[model samples]
Target: MEIKIKNLTKIYKNIKVLDNVSLEIHNGVFGLLGENGAGKTTLMEIISTLLPFDDGEIEVAGLNVKKEPLKVCEILGYLPQKFDFFPKVTLEESFDYLCKLKGMNNSESRKQEINLRLQEVGLLSEQKKYIQELSGGMKQRFGIAQALIGNPKIILIDEPTVGLDPHERISFRNLITRISRDKIILLSTHIVQDIASTCKNLMVLQKGKVNYFGSTIDLINKVRGKVWLYNILDDEIPHVDLFVSLQDKGSSIEIRYIADNPLQGSISTEPTLEDAYIYINRKELTV
Candidate 1:
C-alpha cells in the first residue's frame, strides 16, 4: 500500500496549518515528527480523511482522497492522540462493537478476529477485563487493536506513548514495529525518541513546513561531531543557548548538549537521533 501527497495545503482561521507539504509513504513505519502546533496532527487528519485539504492532491492506493473518501476509509486505520472506549465495557465487547461498525456482523467470525487482534497487541489475556481496568499502555494497545479490526493497509497513530512510563513506552514502540510488515504505519509524535526508535523514514515539520524529510540515519548525520558532553554542578549550571539534556551524578551533573562550538572542557561526543532533532528544530537559532 502507498499514500502519495503532492503539495498539500490546509488553512484554518486564515493560517496555513499545512503549507505545500508533499510526501510518499510506503509499506513500513513512516514517522511524522514535530513540536506542538507544528501541523503533525493536522496533516494526519487530512491523510486519514478526517479533514480536507485546501490545495494539492492526496492519493491512497490510487484513489483520490477528496473524491473517494469512503473507499479510503475502507483501508485505513487510525489511533488518534486521545481516545476512549466504554468505561464499563469489556475489551472483547469493545472489539465486537468496532468490528460490527466495520460491517463484520458475523458473531463467530468477529469473535475469532477479535481474539487475533488482542493477541497481536499482547492483550489477549485482558480481553475479558473492563476497558477502564487496563493500564495506560494496555489502553493504547487496545486502541491499536480496534484500529486493526478490518485489516487496514495503512495505520495512523498520533502520540500513542505520551503518558506511558518508560517501560510501557518502549513496549508500545516494539509493538508498532512488530505489526508493521506489509502495511503503511504512520506514527506521529512530538517525542523525539519515539521517532528515533520506531521509524526508518521520517519527516520533521516546523511551523507548518517540512524542515527535514528523509531517512532517519541521514537526519542523525546532520549533527555528526556536533554533540558534546561535560560536567557541571546542579546548582551552578550555566544557561545554555543550545538544546542541552542533563544526567545527574551523585555530586555533579553530566550534561550532553549539541552546539556548533562547544564550551571549553566539553568532550565531543557522537550525536544520537535526539541530538539531531534538537539541532534541526533549533537550526535557525544556532545559525
Candidate 2:
C-alpha cells in the first residue's frame, strides 16, 4: 500500500505552511523529521484529512483524499500530536466512544475489537483504568489503540513521544516497531532517536521544504567525515559549524561535533542520524 502525494501545498493567512510538499509513502514505518514549525504537523493533518490543502493531490491507497474524504477516513487512523481523551472516561469507555464514531454499531463486535486492540497495545489488563490515571506512555499506547479501532490501512502519528521519559520513550518506540507491518505508519517527530531506531525511510523537512528524503542509513552517511570526537580537558576543539552532541565525562566534557576540518587532537568519529540532521540544519544541506 502507498500514499501518493504530488505538489501538495498549504497556506495560512497568505503564508505557505507547506510549500509544494510531495511524498510517496509505502507500507511499514516511515518518518517525518523536522524541528518545530517545519510544516510537519500540517503535512500530517493534510494526509489524515483533518485539514485542507491549497494545491496538489494526495491519494491514500489509490483513493483521492479530496474526492473521497469519507472513504479515506475509513481506512486512515490518526494519532495527533496533542491527542487527549475525556479525563473522566475509562479506557473501555473511550474505546466504546471511538468505536461508535467509526460506525461500529454491533455491541459484540465493538467489544471484541476493543479487546483485541487493547491486547495488541498491551493495555488489556488496564482497560478499566480511567483516562486520567494513565501515565504519558500509557496514554500514547491507548491513543494507538484507539487509532486501530477501524483496522486502518494508514496510521499517521504526530510526535508520539514528546513528553515521555527515557524508558517510556524506548518502550513506545518498540511498540511502534512491533506493529509497523503490512500498513503505512507515518511517524512525525523531531527526536532523531525515534527515526534512527524505528524508521527505515524518512524525510527531513526544513522550513516548509524537503531537505532530505531517503533511507535512514543514507541520511547518517551525509555527515560522514564531518563528525569528530574531541576531549575538552586535553585540547580545545575547533569552532565547528555544527555541534551534534556533547556528553559529560565528569573530568572532561567529550563533544561530538561536525565541521569541515577536524582539530589537531580530535579524532574522526562515525556519523549518527542526529549528526546528519544537525549538519543539514547548520549548512542548509539540500537533497
Listed per model in order, the count of residue pairs whose N, CA or C atoms clash below 3 Å is: 0, 0
Question: Candidate 2 has what TM-score?
Answer: 0.94
Q: What is the C-alpha lDDT of each candidate?
A: 0.89, 0.89
Give each model a TM-score.
0.92, 0.94
lDDT of 2 by residue, 1-287 (tens): 89998998899999998888888999899999999999999998898888999999999999999999999999989898867889999999989989999999999999999999999999999999999999888899999988888888888899999999999899989988888888899999999999989999999998898998889889888888989998887555447666766677989988777878777788998888888888777743321
Highest TM-score model number: 2
The deviation in Å at residue 21 for candidate 1 is 0.8
What lDDT score goes with residue 276 in model 2? Answer: 87
User: What's the alpha carbon RMSD for model 2?
Assistant: 2.8
What's the residue-level lDDT of 48 in candidate 2? 84
